[model samples]
Target: MSELHHYLELNDPVAMVWRKGNSQDPFTDRNDLLPVINGIITLLEIPSSQHKVHIDGMVEINQELYNQTSALLPEQFLVNYANGSIQFHPQHEGATFSCKYKGKGLILYPASRIYAMVRRHPDVVKTLQEIIDEAHTKLNDTHLAMDQVEQAIREAHDASAKASMAADWASQAAANATDAAHNASHAVDSTKLLFKPAVSDMKELLRTHLNPQVGWTVQTYKDGIRYRYDGKDWVPIDIFGKNIQLVNEHTDGLMSSSEHSKLKSIPLETKERVIVFCLPSYLFQGVQNIVARFPFKGEIVGIKAICGVPGDTDSEIIIEKSMNMKDWHNIMSRPVQLDAFSHYDDGQAVVDRATVYAGDCFRLHVVKQGLNIQNVTVEMIIKI
Candidate 1:
């Protein structure tokens, strides 16, 4: 009747519509008014004391159950429908506070006063009339719409308009077909974009073979993605993040590895391939751990890595493969940090990301003959 409560001010009491005896409603039980009551309670800021504020000698007229929510009571605030209330840490209320419902020396707060104050406003009275008119109009329109829908459905069942109905459906289908065609055109454009690289490659191949030297030069670079061979190894150098400067690219790669082979008692540069062991059976079951140092002992291929530190350094790492559970204590007890490693398969140095287990064919396995190797531990430095 009163515009159905479009808005409520913070201080406006809710009892005007919710509290038992505080409001006049033909329906809505007092016990079922918790939400409306709590909504108002959520407002109204009242100061609190540190210790709990408890009120007794009260009575609850409503039939709602409070036992279920008592355990979930917040730390600093408390609410009692009537009989009693316990506010823990009363002094530290939240940004918003609660008000007194009924207690000794406490003025009673109800909503009858609120409803009267608001309903008396001239603008509110006008709005209420508008709301009543809108409701009636909407109800009439709803009935008319339902009748129209029913008549339309009945006509659809009639055979007299078969041609008209067919035409309507055909028009809709034509629109859909047009949209699908448009979408297919876009898809073709996307397909062209997807194959642009392949087309360019083929064109270049044709041009190179047909003309033989129109826009081509022959050169070879280092065996790494980062380096483009132009007779010598030139690493990608982007200066000012714009132009690429061709410089020497240093890399560490595995040459070869074997579980049975030793370090060969030689310097790393002397061998093109690295002699390392496979991963531990316990850490990665059924797999081999093989790695090589920088300046590989054999031909470099794919991606490669080397020991990061200068070969002239005085550090001695203990390299171990096929680690047993009992040897874990020995590895952790070491004072030095471990080094990075790489993967080796068969006799070649390659990068294998697809391998998840040690037994993979792509995996070239190696291991120190014993549980550990002194003066040499292996870690990997992968460069894509």
Candidate 2:
């Protein structure tokens, strides 16, 4: 029988050859290139040479070397298999070969396949590292921004609190200034009352001529009149009831006379024209009658009186003043019947009286008895 030649390819670009004869002598050239055949053939057994002499090479693949070389290649050359195994194609200058390996199997794969599969691991690891680094940087920036926002919030709160406190302090200061201004205004008004030019002169005159006790100072001065009193002066402090003339130094001698007799007798006249100043109608309860007499003689030709009523209604009173004891002059007379005492209800009526006189030593009378009297005020004005 003749012999046959066979070839086997290996992953390292090497081929192995062997010779085979009939079945009775299968490996006829077993000693020829047996080692080289083992380096290429992946199977252990030879092919059948029953009727023909077959020469085939047994390829022995060095799985370790294939894996080491394949690991050096890039992942682009490696393919993923459906069975959880990897297949790699090794392309060298114009030649290419593919080899497959199971993940759990001990079978060796081609060096190119192993190199391509292993090379992808490093790229994946590097990509994952880059992703992780980017994530870390982004997280750090976010944290920094959050810190800045928190700081800004704290500062804003502090500034708002300070502004609120400042506003409160300013409000308090304004209120204090307003209160101080009010108090100062009141003090100025009081000082003006104490140093009024006319009232001060009148006080000095009273102090010199009247022999009044000390502490009899004027407290209120208005409308050409002064209200004065000592600590113990309780005689009502009325200028009219005292009967002494503040100008002519004469007393009203008819003050003790009965109303009927005074009504019938002619009152003494004043030579110098006298002026009687009273408070406003609202403050008329504090009004005082001041009599100033003069020396002269003339006929009683005129009689006039002024009466003031505050917030008067139709039911108010009208009183008459008389120059001659027999004749009455209607100063505030009305046709309708009026309440003669309406002024007493509000305490807001003032009566000022003057008479054209015919003689010196004028007499004046101002009387009030339980807010009612025959005459509230009587004054005589005489010619000079």
Indicate which candidate wins on lDDT.
2
Tens digits of per-residue lDDT for model 2, 1-384: 333332346433322233334355334222111221211222132322231111211111234655677542422232222222222233322322222121211122333332222255355333443555678999999999999999999999999999799799999999999999999976654343222223433546455536544334342222233444433451223232333333222333323235445555765753455433332222111112232333343433233333344123222332343344434443322211213444333333333433334422332222221222122222223345
Model 1 per-residue lDDT tens digits across residues 1-384:
211232356554432222222234222211111122322233122112221232221212222334445433332234443323333332333323323332121123433332222354354433444565678999999999999999988887776677678899989999999999999976654333111111122334344444332122322222222211122322232122222343322322232233113444444543222333333222211122343333311221232223322222122223222222222211112212222232211122333231122211122222212122122324333221
Per-candidate TM-scores read 0.18, 0.15
* Model 1 backbone overlap count: 44
| Residue 352 in model 2: lDDT | 40
lDDT of each: 0.32, 0.36
